[model samples]
Target: MAASPTTGRGRPDSLDHMIRLTSLTRRYGRTTAVHDLTLTVRSGHVTGFLGPNGAGKSTTLRMILGLTAPTSGTVTVDGVRFRDRPRGLRHVGALLDAADVQGGRGAEAHLRALARSNGIPRSRVDATLREVGLAGVARRRVGGFSLGMRQRLGIAAALLGDPPVVLFDEPFNGLDPEGVRWVRGLFRELAGQGRTVFVSSHLMSEMEHCVDRLVVIGRGRLLADQSLAEFAATSGGSTVSVRTPQEGALTARLTAEGGVVRAEDDGTVTVTGLSAARVGDLAAAHRIPVHELVTRTPSLEQAFMALTATSVEHRAGEVAR
Candidate 1:
């Protein structure tokens, strides 16, 4: 699927980054999960936090929500330290993992407890459950919920706060294709309403169609911070396909013009590097008959793999240890 425009290059200057990490670091004994990472998640956009397995995405989010203290640096919400603000959580609603929900309580009871703690009306509990398509199952024990249903229930709890910023970590893990589409639409609608929606996932292919801006990390280090279009342009170059009646003549001409040419089993030559117009011009100049010409755009998933290949952490040692 083609990626739709998520940002129009008019990034707001509100310092309004709903979430910011300044030189954030987290260490687990000898291993550093996140290494002096710094990033800003602006409002009115959905920022995709992408990385490979064990890339410290979950750790960074834990620090941001104050679930775990950063060994160095700081994480803040609206310029206030995550741990220092009295109402630190009032500005952010997060779903770090499906299991974050209490297994002992019913889904409705869980949401009600949070609502009461935050001084939100009881009516909001039902509203959020229904909003997440969990109204029918809201009364069921959370321990009985499927992973996808649990993810939706978690999202319901996050929305219960009605906070300006929402953070989701691998929300699509067990969801079917339709559920993934639903979550994508929900994030877009939230961002459209001028809220900050930050999500993290190891699946770069799915995110290519889901997120606006991307903050990609590998080996616990920042790799690329860019919009989808910019990343595609840098790593996803275009490929040109050409066809001519005289395959041999066209192949010779294209090769001489610095174009990479490969003849298919059928009688046609595919050329790359030269545009269709340039190829046509060359063919016209060489008196070669042109039958067909086209260009195929590369997928964002391919671009992501090409860009992050070198930065991936080798986990062979960890498994052996």
Candidate 2:
């Protein structure tokens, strides 16, 4: 899969693996749901869309699928508007809300209907159900299905078209550990196959494990569109942990070398403003016998909170008691 550059304009040769939004703004009366959002979701990686409550994630996704018309600007899948493309399922597969399915319909029946609507073949229905591990319960009524089961059913429906672009909104909401693991692997697998996999999730931990890129929004505006490593690096780099017998000497040496050293309760010292390799090289240069030398990565949740602190529309701490 090719990694497309984030160019300002023009749809390049990577048409099949790009989802671009340009000056996309959606206003409902006095409320602007999405405002002038512009970014590209490239292929070959799972891109996670993150935002606090009322950040317009769902609205933006709806616009991408042509479910809601933008008040101004444009959104395109494969360099063409979703509205202009008929049989849309053939291009993009999305699981916005798992509970949107008809309660009275059977799992297989529901998928069959979607396939028919998209002019997809009936053969895809069973195959997708099997892929989502719902083939055994294909005849079960959606109303009787558990939340996790319904989620799987919804995933099957999205994949029924075998589309190149896949979008998932809060996919970890109703999944068990096994299901979560499966979905994680599935997203990576899809991206590995050159498909554009975009996911919106509040599970920061899960996002850290699965996605390598991030698109963060707050209050209907694009806050950050960067790779996961780059986004996390905004908070600061990693800290290095060192365990040595010569604590005073090492501390003085590290501080003298411009590394911020902090004494830990675990009888070890943590050094920031420098990497593990630097710390190790410094210790070796000073003849310090280091027992433990490791680097701790930055926390994604902490970084996200810092970036979107003011942009949070619904603040829990400000609620009236």
Candidate 3:
């Protein structure tokens, strides 16, 4: 599948914000599924929502879509909750569960029924089917469709309204590599159109390319709400690697300059909080033989893992309260 069509003016600002959640929470009896969560899905960008399994990602999305009522906070779309209007769904589009499709109905038939219920024209159904690369399978029974095809159909159904805001929860699951790439391009195209594209995925690598900004949650709290660059900036500096035949001498010199040097088994010393050039100057001043000196920045995944290690550790076996 290729990318979907880009709508340059998809989100009309005068219509109000697409979605807003303030101090939102959901309690399941004694367990709190989502706790004091607050986030904003803005227009003109794709926001990645991430958390480990049982980390309240689903609970928070459900509350935003008005499927599950929040225990204590508010979720408002276009400044109104979905329940407040007879046709509240008109302002937004959503594909919360890929498996929620009607198995008995044909893909086109199901879409037609949904479109009719929402007072959308029948012509829009074909347009949406084509948009999601499901035109060939539109008339087939949904029961026979593979999970990837079903996901495409679900996305098509969400686009039927041509709504300003789109919310997809774990839209990439069960997709092949090609399908994943297709979906990533689709998300980028959608955001390019100025629609508020909010998607939830457990795969951070996928989000790294698909989203313009990230709203990461750990143990049901916002860990970060930043652009990719800002997240990288705050994650910290790079590691300086120095390869020297005189490992002991180089390590001693580095340590003397307040640099923490860890001697690797490969005879290279890894220095922290110091630049490679500075290390080279220090080595030259001390007459240490330097074979190689380089600085390697941490990747986004590495930075995220390091920053959230404590949160992840604390949430282990806790079942997300």
Candidate 4:
């Protein structure tokens, strides 16, 4: 599917590479996997999909790929349903599961099969392997490849058609540190080329660095969808860490002064609804000698946990070490 400049192959067309989900819902018997989801994933940005377990992420992705039917509502790629489009791979490339590939086939053979089915150029297969750093292992059977190698091969297949829209579920699962950095750069480069890139992963730190936008869901419902910065800013958890020998006294003093204090396992107290300066002042006024006082901005993981805390399907108890 080498896109001709005039026919708009490499870049998006008049619709500008948008995935629109309107009241998109899916149900299994009495259980609803997705509830009235409505959002637009636009081109030129890497959108991260996030949720706790059983948030209907896999079901939603399947519905978008036309592999599963929604109970109600609709999902459209570039203003048209995915199933309605002939040769859909040229419009949307996805990696739902890297392990779904045939293990008996060579890496090149697997990609060739995909290319043939999608009407993608046979020659593009080799080029994609080289692009994904799999050229050296093109003829290697997928069964012999490591998890990291399998991930690269799967990425190569997704880029085989050079589609305008791509979705990846946990693309960094088996990547090394170097591979992780490469994938992050790849997402940015694709977004720079005006493609709609939607990725779903539980790695909050990776998402913080990779995605420009975030779409968070919990309990089959939309929890947050906005720019990464905007979502982080909304966490509303500006906290100060206070470490002192008299932790109990300091915590009591901070709480008495209308501050929320959460004890840490490290013998420190995290003070909220107050500033570092106020925490220091309270410690001094209460005659508590402070060892450390530092303000901390909430990370993406912290923000995600805060939003999905109530929505977790099965909360695990702390394991004693």
On lDDT, the candidate that comes out on top is 4
Relative to the unseen true structure, what is the C-alpha lDDT of residue 150 in candidate 1, on a scale of 0 to 100?
87
lDDT of 3: 0.80
**lDDT tens digits, residue span 45-121, model 2:** 89999999999999999999999999999999888998897798888899999999899999999999989999998
The global Cα lDDT (0 to 1) of model 2 is 0.87
Which of the numbered candidates is closest to the native, going by highest TM-score? 2
Q: Model 2 RMSD to the real structure?
A: 6.0
- Least well predicted 10-residue stretch by lDDT in candidate 1: 1-10
How would the candidate models be sorted by TM-score, starting from the highest?
2, 1, 3, 4
Stretches of candidate 1 off by over 4 Å are 1-17, 264-272, 314-321
TM-score of each: 0.85, 0.89, 0.85, 0.83
Residue 164 local lDDT, model 3: 72
Off by over 4 Å in 2: 1-15, 319-321
* RMSD, every candidate, angstroms: 5.3, 6.0, 3.6, 5.3
Please identify which of the two predictions, 2 or 3, would achieve the higher lDDT against the true structure: 2
Model 1 lDDT vs. the true structure? Answer: 0.79
> How many Å off is the CA of 81 in candidate 3?
1.6
Clashing residue pairs found in predicted model 1: none
Q: 19, model 4: CA deviation in Å?
A: 1.0
lDDT over C-alpha atoms for residue 226 of model 2 = 91
